[model samples]
Target chain A: MHMIQSVGIIGCGALGRNLFHNLKPLEGLTVECFCRSIEKDDSLYQSSVRKIEELFHCDLILIAVSDQDIIEVGQILNAYSGIVAHCSGATPLHNFNGKGGVFYPLQSFSRSVIRSFKEIPLFIEGDNEETTIQLYSFAQRLSNQVEQLSSEKRQKLHLAAVVSQNFSNHLIALTQAYLEKEGISFQALIPLLEEGLGNALYQNAREIQSGPARRKDTKTLDAHLSLLKEEKRLLPLYEQLSESIKTYYEEDF
Target chain B: MHMIQSVGIIGCGALGRNLFHNLKPLEGLTVECFCRSIEKDDSLYQSSVRKIEELFHCDLILIAVSDQDIIEVGQILNAYSGIVAHCSGATPLHNFNGKGGVFYPLQSFSRSVIRSFKEIPLFIEGDNEETTIQLYSFAQRLSNQVEQLSSEKRQKLHLAAVVSQNFSNHLIALTQAYLEKEGISFQALIPLLEEGLGNALYQNAREIQSGPARRKDTKTLDAHLSLLKEEKRLLPLYEQLSESIKTYYEEDF
Candidate 1:
């Protein structure tokens, strides 16, 4: 696999914008960002070209549009014979028309958050070995953690990621909301939350598990449930998650 | 309220051991640990006094036993007239005898993990103003983030801590298990996990939430459920948590 000379990014959303910014500075990598908006003093990569055909001059085209629009972008690039990929974790490789590949970064990005691509784990899957190697080489330039995964396995990884990120964040949100109702500030819980994450990273979660649910402290559990009774939406989640924790620990006990 | 001259810790578990180590280094604070084990030329503050009455010598007695043993420790300390506090977050102030107070650190501690008390949110509550001020001054020596919280509010905070720590760690465990089965390393997901925690700390979780669940993508959800069918324990948690996310976002849509 050789160094990628040029790369084209479609869409200017968080993923695309970050991708463009990350790839733009890499040596021997010329990035062209295609978007609807254009400025007179736009960067060298920013292009107002709406025609997908005109922007197919790059060695690779990275689709960073919405999930629904990914297939359409692939279809529009069907005429091009160059390597094509989408930055979607959940989407399958078959969505692309030609030289299909997935260059999904297992990360949650926002316009405001200045995230470095150095440690972001990238999952690349392609229609064939050649495409996979090409995308892997391209991804390696942007991130140190790059691996080749099958579409099936990548989908599973994506699902696991949803649990690790979205579901975990939801639990934190529940914590914040519960404390807010009690006139306690959210900042107070940050240390506990950070320590919890640190423990999860370094230790086995099973051994490190604590709380009323894991301890089977019915009194504390009942007190929490009573406190959450008024929170109709949270009550069910609290019960379900706590019940799961209890069930998991009870097996060992 | 001016300063704590001497302190007694009642347990030798993770919290008690760590507290003794942290407090022993502070100026003007002499920590006497009351544990079962006694050693010759033991470190400063390692007092293996089997007699509970000997703990009454300190200005304050901090009970650091397990939740079940807290009441018994408090009962033993019923004869003492000095300020008494339990380090248990879930246990209320009423559980203690004499001048009761709470000196709860909002951080998780493990035997193997070396954690500093600095910046750890210290939630303190006493039966009365005098006890509260005395404990506050003592807590100030150990940490900068100290606050006075009512028992009712601290119990709610404990519940919130359980969600943020236990439930979230369970999700990370789930991630590790899933990835390991696929021959993927846990280290691969650390960046994403760290980023997710950073997001929850700084941004609004609801606004930053992402995934097929947030998008209500039924196709991906079905695929994930099928993949998780073999995981009897994790499947239900996956379904319930995803459903909760779906429900939360659906209301807005």
Candidate 2:
């Protein structure tokens, strides 16, 4: 059994709170926390400290603060002898001086939506081998899909994640907004959405892409464009996407 | 028992082939097909008619052709003394003069990928109430989820489907392309992709959107923008989407 006696967490935000809940329940792991605002409910996991210096005694310290606060949090814990890690996908691990690593959990977390960490991909990176091993084991405890990635690769992965999740959600939102304006049911698009994502699991999305744009159906494309003529912002988006799809298939054929 | 005695499918494309496989197995339904090219393999799914006029004799003739071909197919079967339906989401039901409706299955189909029609949403629209009930019962034999939609609403649904499936797939392909150029593993983004899409099934994507733009982190946004300096096409898309996300949150906050 690998030993991880005490883990310190900074910042009690959604990610931090989730980490606390998941870690506190694991056997042989004592979780200590420090946050700016100590709530009464936070005491259920463990008593959180008021100062950052108090958490320096732990075997591992996890900085679960915002991206802006990461550098400041690292500076605050500069003298800490314990291993340090920040849970961020975009932020560079080199922002910290020593013994720093990344512990990014790739999921959109909400307070209301409780997600099991068992399947969540945990991307970890460390400055050195020993720290990497420890970080890997730490992540392995929470997730089956634990990957060790470099800072540069992790940054690229973060960009992809942003596109795959945030951008896709915005597109779906735009779709819903457009449909609602015309008194159409959003339910009509759910099956298509599910089927599209389901196809991605079995094949490359490029191969399974189906639409007027993919087929280069100029008539249907013109019709769709005409409908979006009133919306200046959306018109360009539709045109660009349709043009790109057309260009992609044009290149292929 | 719901009697869909004889069903005729026009066009033996991926969608038509899939429909044939799913509908042919049903005990109460007999599926006949018509394709532009009558291939040897297609003989397994009943004898496909070489001409469209041959299908007009069936109880229900389904024009499962391309969007561009729907009008042409409709004209070919103008004097058909039976219910005629085109399996298209975008093409207006008005394209056909008489005895025509819609029997659209909301999915992306490929010859290699076999999907069950039981869970697939079949959108049915008819020229009249009697035709609507007949179409509904016909759809019920294959799928549990059958919905009646008007031409106007179905048009909007088609627009939404374009955005949800086609647009999302394009964004994912772009992400993969970007990551591949940097020697980053596409595998890193899979978990995030799966989680994001899975969340869409349970929650509205707008509520769970997360990224630098959603957080309005200008620093990280600039970093990502700078990284895409060489890729002029992707840079504009990235900037526009990020700006949209920022503006969306700015309104809320």
Candidate 3:
């Protein structure tokens, strides 16, 4: 059996809370944290008097803080010889100066809902071979789909995620804004929304692309544009994105 | 017990295929289609005939085609007076001239893969009171979640869907293209992709938004943009989307 005894988590924000909560239930692992606000509980094994010194004892120190604070935390944790990892999608392991690694759970986590880590893919990146093996083994315990990824690869993945999740969510929000402006209930689009997401799973997105823009049906595009003429902000977005889509499917039409 | 004898599918594409296959095994419903291609199996009761007169015989005609094609199909089917409907997201039932309704399944359909319609929501719409009732009854048999939507409302919903699914998919494609150019496999982003989609189900996306753009962390954003500096096409997308995200979180930040 693989032994992963003590884990220290820095920053008890959303990601930290999730990790701590989830990791607490696992056997043969004890979790500690160095939070600005410390709570009295037996579950939390240790609290750091000084953040840098906290890394000396634990087998793994997870820095679940903001990107801006990662380097600072890394510099502080550099003194210790333990496996220091951060849970960020974009930041590279090299930011830790060969002392730490990345233990990125490629999921959007929240405090209210419990996410299933079993099938969730964990992207691991390490500075050295020993740390890589250790991190991969740790990830394997939590998920079946764990892999070693380079910083460049991880960065690319992060950019893709921004498109898939963040930007996509913004689109939904924009749609909601448009509907609300038109006195339409957001609930009306639920079915169509579901279908759109569902369709992409089975078909290549390039093949399934549709709309006035894809067809280059100038008439329909003009009509849609005309309908949104009153909304100045949305008009430019509609026009730009439509042009992009038209350019994408220019050969098809 | 509800009696369903035969289902008439207008478009023999992905959505049509799904409906045809799912309704095939139902107790009393036999599926038939009026497709443009004769390549589809005749044994499955699919016909290549385009004329509406030939298809007017069925008890339920489900139009599963493009928005632009809906009016043309609806105009022809309006003469037959059978329970006419289309499986379009944004098109209105009034387009069917009270002779038809909508059997809009709120799930994405791909002909290559079989999916369960049980969990998928179905949005029903009609021109008249009786047709709406009938459409609702029909939708209830296949799906657990069914809603009555108006044409105007459905149109708004469709617009929102464009934002959520279509635009989001485009972002994914763009990200894939960008990464592939850098010799990165787009497959690496699947975990993040799945997580992003899965997260939307439980939480409001606005609350969970993360990224250098969302954070207004110029250092990281600049670093990301610097990497994409050579790619002329992606730079604008990266900048515009980053601006949009920043604009969205302006109040909170």
Candidate 4:
């Protein structure tokens, strides 16, 4: 890898913009950002995000667009002679030309919040050994934890991330709505949740799994099912989730 | 309500044992433990847990038994002349004659962990005003957060708790198992989960809901489904959960 000095970031969504600002502090690195329209805050990226053609010759070009746009963006950056990577878990390394790679950050980014990139896990992959090392070194500069993950392994990781982070968060949100509808304070459950999650983390989630479904307490489960009779929307979800729990614990592996 | 000087706790399960140990420190209160058989650790409860006859005459007998056993224990204490509260979210207040009440703690307890009982929310319910106040004041001594919740409301609270804490914890367990199967360190996902959860709590889970399903990104969603195909048990769960997420956000009310 030639002594990489300049980096180009595409898109100004949550991740793209954040990477542009976060990478600016690296020693002797000139960061440039490209987007269709340059917003006021996006000026942090080399004064303003210009055009994609301006980024073609940079030492490294990272496409921070959505999964659907990754292939198109990669094609647009096809002329680039440097390493071209798309920060996507779903998109593969072969989406771009010979030098294409991946620089995916596992954490979900918010457009408004400028967060420290140090703790986020960045998964890197490249077309070849040289590109792999180049991409790994670049990702290591942004996040302390960087792994050389393949397209298949990275997809599995993304699926796990979706179920654990996104699904659990949605479940909490449903509970929040339930409590609010019942005229109960959602704050009442926060202490209990914190303690439960703490115990799960400490003792391991498998060892400490409990509740009516885990216990196979038919009476309690039936009572809950009846309680959700009016909540037709949540009824099927509750059933599906309960069935999954039972299948996991009760069935033979 | 008479100044309850004596308290009797029945059963030696996780919540029961924990409550018995925690309530021992209340100033000027005599606490007795009554279980079928006393184990070595049961010595902390008035030297040892004895027969149910000994707990019958106590000023306040808290039946810390399972939901199914609450009625039996309440009947055994029916000969008493004071508040007989069953510390159950599932069992109602009408189980223990006119003196029947509820002293349910909202947090799950482990038998081995002697956790500080300060922050756990205790929901109190009684058949009458006198019993309600008696249980409320008694519970206030045990935990800082005490509320007079009706049986219906407490049932609703318990349902919310089941879905939020228990279900979400199980999701993480599944994710852990998946990551382990792939020979990936579960530690990699922790940082992302913590950061994502923090943002969800701060901004709101509903506002921060992002994932293939939520975005209606069929390509990524299909990729995840196929990835989970090798995991036969998890494939249905993946589909159902994704469907629920789509229903919650994508569909019109």
Write down the worst ten-residue block by lDDT for model 1 chain B. Answer: B38-47
Which predicted model would earn the best DockQ?
1
For model 4, the stretches where C-alpha displacement exceeds 4 angstroms are: A40-45, A201-203, B40-46, B201-203, B251-253
The digit string of per-residue lDDT tens for model 4 on A137-242 reads 8788888988999988888888888988888888887887788888988777887777676555545787678888888888989999999998865788789888
Chain B vs. true chain B: TM-score per candidate:
0.92, 0.93, 0.87, 0.93
Give the total clashing residue pairs for model 2.
Answer: 0
**Residue A62 lDDT, candidate 3, scale 0-100:** 90
Runs off by more than 4 Å, candidate 2: A1-4, A43-45, A95-97, A112-116, B1-4, B25-29, B43-45, B95-97, B251-253
Candidate 3, residue B138: the lDDT equals 76
DockQ of the candidate models in sequence: 0.74, 0.61, 0.39, 0.73
Question: Which tens-of-lDDT digit does each residue in B8-99 have in candidate 2?
Answer: 98888888888888888889777788877775765444567667777766888888788887777777777777888888878888536566
Ranking of all predicted structures according to DockQ, beginning with the best and ending with the worst: 1, 4, 2, 3
**Of 2 and 4, which scores higher on DockQ?**
4
Each model's RMSD to truth, in Å?
A: 2.6, 2.9, 4.6, 1.8
* Pairwise DockQ winner, candidates 2 and 3: 2
lDDT per residue for candidate 3 within B1-253, as digits (tens), equals 3344776787877887788778777776766777766464554444345565777767778888876788777777656766888887655565465557777775566667778788776778877777788778878888887888777666556656666666766766666667667786666566666666655534566666776777788987887787778876567777777787788766552
lDDT-best of 1 and 3: 1
Residue B76 in candidate 2, Cα distance off native in Å: 2.2
For A1-253, candidate 3 gives per-residue lDDT tens digits of 3455788889877788778877877789877777776556623435443454755688888999988888787787656767889988888785464557899987777756666787777899888887888999988888888989888878777776776667776666666667667776665456555566655544476677766677777765665676677865557767777777777765452
Q: Where does model 3 sit among the CAPRI classes?
A: acceptable
Q: Residues B127-207, candidate 1, lDDT per residue (tens digit)?
A: 888889999988988898999999888888888887788889888877887788887677777788887788787778877
User: DockQ for the candidate 4 complex?
Assistant: 0.73
lDDT value, residue B252 of candidate 2: 43
CA lDDT for candidate 4: 0.81
Chain B TM-score of candidate 4 stands at: 0.93
